[model samples]
Target: MSSTVVETRRVFEVKNLDVYYGDTRALRDVTMDILEGQITALIGPSGCGKSTLLRCFNRTNDLIPGAEVKGELNYRGQKLYGKEVNPIVVRRRIGMVFQQPNPFPKSIFDNVAYGLRVNGIRDRLNERVETALKDVGLWDEVKDNLKKLGTSLSGGQKQRLCIARAIALQPDVILMDEPCSALDPISTKRIEDLMNNLKEKYTIVIVTHNMQQASRVADYTAFFNAEALDNGGRVGYLVEVDTTEKMFHDATDERTRDYISGRFG
Candidate 1:
């Protein structure tokens, strides 16, 4: 008898997931399993629900007015959308970094310390901040400017600070929505390296339009595409999910192949 072994353990299990904004369906029946301690990139053109799917992992979509989500989304076998689940608690466990760097106007130290404070972690606050900064490779650059306003830093520095803020909580997973989209090529390379290092400690899910970035950084890649509806609109859905190597070179889905080849976004 032959048997198959699943080596990668799943952190998030999504089944038949659908998201809606008012009456318009944004995502439809998107289902995939995200592995723990690995980088999974969501790649697609704009308006294809890449960000929507990213938000579903931590329930950030709940904060959006008129947004509704259906189907099963489980975090480590726990019902993610259960009535007993607290969005605040969920966010702490699954932190997020946005498209643009959005550090608070507070001091660099305080910005990284913000989540720890909100979680009432007063002990060793400085140590935790320092560790988080070090994890993102920002400690050497900003160690002398700990008291400086976070906003005073350069764009790349601000992004690293935001990453440090998220890492301070020691989150199980980190959701990044185009984190390097607004940075220069050098800064983008730095963040890519940071992502590779972070996967040793945390699972990462990123929404990116850059195919090269996905191919370069992700271990697994999921392709999303929009389908036109009869009502003259569209709904985004998952087209394929596979190892980065296979997805780029041997994708089974034609849609995925076309998208990866730059035939169509």
Candidate 2:
């Protein structure tokens, strides 16, 4: 009998990617592919470069002084870190949501409209804002309160608003850094559900310490760990990247198994 096969396209191809802050190497020899239209989770112990790696996706690392990257990084078969690449353009296509729900102090409608305005999207502003808000499941609650200050909302609502802000730009990839870290269980569940839905529309890369959350939302998972050096310093590197089911249940690397089993991080 003949078998049918399916192919998945890669959105980001990272080869021997290393990130350095001044003289210190924060990440080392990282190599992986971020597949298109799937949620890829970056899970690991603290200071293991999960967040650092996430920032590299959209070149947000450029914002940090002394931050430098080496090795090849490609997005959509194009060089992501090439001299001709514009960090602003990269960010416009690859949006980010920080660990904290950092909504502008502006009104709710203006908050979601912020990116649209900055990008010079003048036509159908209301439609775009409405679509993004509805996509993140935030419109119903804040529809009438569009003029209200975003900071006045509850923590969960604010985070959802931040998410709306990102999606309003219609980005191709969404990089979330511990998006639900500060929220309660109820809020976290809401965000997790939202993530599962969003993956159908945008490629997602999340840096999470919560193994359960990774298993719940991610289709693929990459585990990172800190390797000690002779000089009393450490560098974070990818241990394994695999289907979430395999990574959580049958990871090949002992370190991955250990981290998943709560043995060590």
Candidate 3:
């Protein structure tokens, strides 16, 4: 008797997704499944819609004027773009950490507690804040400096603070857009290690131009590229997606192979 291993549950199911800003198409027909409790990386060149696609996961695109999205995006089998869905609620469940560490100009503790306060969660607030900080490996460093301003921390600390802020909400999925782009190599490695550890509790999707970074921390990878449209503008689209090992060593698509091999982005 042969027993088949079941695949992990999918967290996000995107089908033929297209995103537009005004008349310009930013991303076209992107379809992918994000598995639960794994790190999925989006790697591509500039103007290739990696970040645009990440925004679609939490409906952050809706905040931009004239931004339109076409096609289906489901979160845990529910329609993410459904009229009945609330963007605020969606964001709460799908947290985001941007390229820059934009911690609020508040105390370190307050930064992590902001979401809890907004959600009206007062019970065990201190405990929650501490746990969040510890989860991101920042508790020991900032435990005594809880009252200090978040912006006063180093670049690496600031990014971890932002991460603590997100994880404090206990979101099921975390979207990161070039999270380590501005940090030193040591800082970048710290973030990558945190990502590896965090995957046990949360599904992560990251947009990165650093091929090595993607290869280091991602379980799955999606490659995207821009094409010149008939209107003379470039529109980004998915090229290939596969297990990180497969994508790096044996991608079926020539474009994916070339991009991963340093021939072209």
Candidate 4:
């Protein structure tokens, strides 16, 4: 940890957050703060609500049928769940990358320019596309082939293109759900490095099962665990949230240690 004191901005404040799908609770009472310009990793077993909570930040949960979110979720001090909140606007401000690299079928240049065009940002469109691609370190490889289909790239490049799509909107935050889970080791490293660089400009929250990936890239980590239900099911809840150092070394919760130690999921 750095000894120097630094001021931090809170981008999202989640209080007693609970999520349900058709009256069944998936996550309960999740309260955590997402700080700006930092990568916060959400790690836990499957069905532990990491992805569920990640989607909540951008209101993607609203897309699912019968999905319900209760309790308080605030973005930049504004009530995120307020009646006046616009899910579309919320999504534009908080972009997301899904587990699989799901690039649009458009050409490389068009893919990066998609969001900008939607937002009526015709001015400097070329510059924005180039910058977003360069930000993800994809321009050098694909600059000459800008018309190539985004899906034609390798898995890693496709993922990078997807990232370029997200950042092109100049989003305040990026939510990645197991971004590197589908790539090879070399490709994973590239995404990890890209993530480390991205935190300087955009706040990031990622849900990943790879403990090493979380440890290597995240500045903060939130470990979630599930409790057994009477129906032989499990529901996830936040177990611990702390700096990466504290989470990996001296987590306050025994369940967190158990999960970290490989004693249980």
Model 3 off-target regions past 4 Å? 1-6
lDDT of 3 by residue, 40-134 (tens): 99998899999999999999999999999999999999999999999999999999999999999999999999999999999999999999999
lDDT of 2: 0.92
lDDT (Cα, tens digit) per residue for candidate 1, span 70-162: 999999999999999999999999999999999998999999999999899999998999999999999999999899999999999999999
Could you tell me how far off, in angstroms, the CA of residue 207 lies in candidate 4 after the best superposition? 0.6
- Model 3 / residue 192 / CA error / Å: 0.4
Model 2, stretches more than 4 Å misplaced?
Answer: 1-6
**Each prediction's number of clashing residue pairs:** 0, 0, 0, 0
Task: List candidate 1 stretches off by more than 4 Å.
Answer: 1-5
Name the runs in model 4 displaced over 4 angstroms. Answer: 1-6
Task: State model 3's lDDT.
Answer: 0.94
**In candidate 2, residue 73 scores what lDDT?**
92
The per-model lDDT (C-alpha) reads 0.94, 0.92, 0.94, 0.93
All models, RMSD in angstroms: 1.9, 2.4, 2.3, 2.0
